[model samples]
Target: MMKTALHSVSYAGVWPGQARLGLDDFLERTRNLGFDAVMLMAKRPHLSLLDYDADARSRLRQRLAGLGLKVACLAGYTDFCLGAERPDIPTRELQILYVRELARLARDLDCGLVRVFTGFDYANVSLDQQWGWCVTSLRECARQAADAGVNIGIQNHHDAAVHYESLFELVEEINEPNCKIMFDAWSHAPVEKAASAGFRQEGGDLVAAVKKLAPYLVHTTVADYVHRPRYRYQPNLINYICESDALRAVPLGEGFIDYKSFFKALKEIGFDGYVAYEMCSYLRGGGSEENLDGYARKFLDYLSAF
Candidate 1:
């Protein structure tokens, strides 16, 4: 059976002066919220490499043990092509080292997976070069992760290998036994759109997409969003409407994402990985401890139904 885990990001305030919780409190909260496992956000205010030393890691491991909680995975925030404007900076190297260290941390924490991203495409470099950078970096990271007895789950949250075909090719190019995809429905919304618009390729629709990607997915993140339309007033053009879509995060089962279909496909594939819930962006309700906990519990309720 697939396990349910919560991402620390759901409680880690992203905005200034927002709700903030330390790693310990976050873990305790997860336990209180009735989750047996958790995915730690590998950054400050929660599992930052800079913050945790040998002693700190020991204490965290002990705490998890005491609480009877498991570390599902370590979510690493990385963009391999970050410093493309300055080739001398060795941005990819730095990111690879970061992921390597994260793998070590994952081993120490008794976690099997270290989640990562394939860089974004906001650089001046060509797509081929960017893809090459990510592939090389991920291969090295996967090697180190394997050495540490950990696996690397390349999340489809970045532009470097965003599409399913591109991501599959990238993973094949890396050719690491320990490397796999951390597929999520939210990241494949564009493909769903194309499928809805009569694109009939195999696995073009959401259900088929889930089935096609299931074999490669080692982990999946869950979140729901509802689009809020926008309009721009134009004096000359009779109020031109904005083409861009705005999405607001909502509690599970309350958004536009057809998670029932997605979950059914996952079940059909016999997915045996962690299904993590995250509230990383602006939520439907205000961000407070109570609201966050309420939403988190609601996720559990939603998952139980599945």
Candidate 2:
């Protein structure tokens, strides 16, 4: 389908503490919230290895089928390289083997997208050496993933991080159309020229970042927002796009992000993927259904325009 879709809000936007309900409970509520599909997170609460076990695997598949929710992408977070401590042949080979195996499993699960991580640059580390390891690892991952009919979704996270240009460089050099990047809006917003429409800054814009990175835009996130006491900007339980507004982040649309063009760009690029509302809200500590439903409806309407 050329049209983009929304993953079930049941997917953890982050880790363990974020959820108030159990997995099954959340999935039911998420369906009621109107999400069309669901994207699993790469970390705890929804481990990547869940794709391997037959029982756990079968149960997940059956549940989604029963609920009519499609599996959009597996949000896995593994560093392709284990670092120079394992610079030698055997260690490196083992690392590659494990990930390749995981990629194969993801393919078997019919999850075409797997989001891996780019490690942060360390102090005193030479750019060439660090990047050399990263580049080699990603290319190998891409090759194996391609063989498995799966694509790598390189996710963005700051600190010992991979800069936007570096990510672009990696994808371009690898030259595998399937090797894509998952731009976490929080990480992505600052890296690009800030969208001039609503926010101003010497900092980069979210619009420009997404545009420059659009060719490889594998997944995107959204959320609800509200003003915070600090007041420079709102902070939700999580804000997928910014830290500057406050140490506390807000939900989608409730913050400074203008997703009109963000959604438009996906449709323009023919991204047949889910526009997940990354949970920076987590049901806002148990608010009214009217509140959650209103946000979901409004956001869905906003996205459907494109």
Candidate 3:
């Protein structure tokens, strides 16, 4: 990653769900990784809570300044329970309020993005209701985040509203400069008109999906993937790119993302954001800290190709 210094956020591992390391160890490790920044996955011990605040919060803040690591984004998975399956309005509103609290903490730490989501309808609700609720929610969040000078990012999760076309529509509907699609290359290829019409694979170019998405990609994250043998690539790297089912994390550049195309579009859009190296399988098998560190380094190196 020395060839390409990037501000990054890691979700595949590090500061994970129910991590036993607490905040100090997490920040200390992130600083040691030579990562300029870190994104706290705010599931538990969210740095905003003052009570029972693990000394880790204060300690992590000190370590960040001491180590010169920038807190980049506070990655949170939040919504208004707009989905029919989990329609809990009061609870989701409270969660968003909690996220705002986290944003205040992030501002104190000098981070940038508070990555959240548009509630899922990936394949469920009627497009009208889905887009309506999604647009309204994002616009409000954007207004709030803008007032706070924090950008709100909508993660492209694959449930309903986040499907390629659906998301494009949502972004267009919201039309908030503060709200943007945090393009995740691992998500589904944009649904082609032909595909939506049920004749896509017949002749539609899959690469077009990335083109369709690039327009709204205000934030970019670069990862690794390998192409299929059919592509005739060297080292078996850069073979294919696709999403993962296990933990929903894809190894960087191993699927069909077409980074060349992605990078081209990114440049066109002028995306100057975190290229989070969020690769998976790096922390499996109870690897030693040194092993994980080395693995992280190598992945970082691989990511420098862009």
lDDT of 2 by residue, 1-306 (tens): 232334333344343344334456656766776777667654445545644477777786678778877667766555543455645556455656656766776665567887677666665567676667666777787888888888887777633234566667777876777789876655655444234434644335455566778888877655544333333343774444444433234434555455666666666767666776554444553344455445556666666556
Give the worst 10-residue stretch by lDDT in candidate 3: 1-10
Best by lDDT: 1
Flag the better candidate by lDDT, 1 or 2: 1
For each candidate, the alpha-carbon lDDT, in order, equals: 0.85, 0.61, 0.58
Could you tell which candidate, 1 or 3, scores higher by TM-score? 1
**RMSD of every prediction:** 2.1, 6.7, 7.8
Candidate 1 global CA lDDT score: 0.85
Candidate 1 lDDT, tens digit per residue, 68-146? 8999899998888888678789888888899989999998999999999988887368888888888889999999889
What TM-score does each of the candidates earn?
A: 0.94, 0.72, 0.70
Greater lDDT among 1 and 3 belongs to 1
Sort order, TM-score high to low: 1, 2, 3
The residue ranges of model 2 lying beyond 4 angstroms of the native Cα positions read 1-17, 20-22, 80-95, 158-163, 192-204, 223-245, 280-298
Write candidate 3's Cα lDDT for 187-267 as tens digits.
544333325557555422324545676666655555543322233345568565443223322344444456666665555
Root mean square deviation (Cα) for candidate 1: 2.1
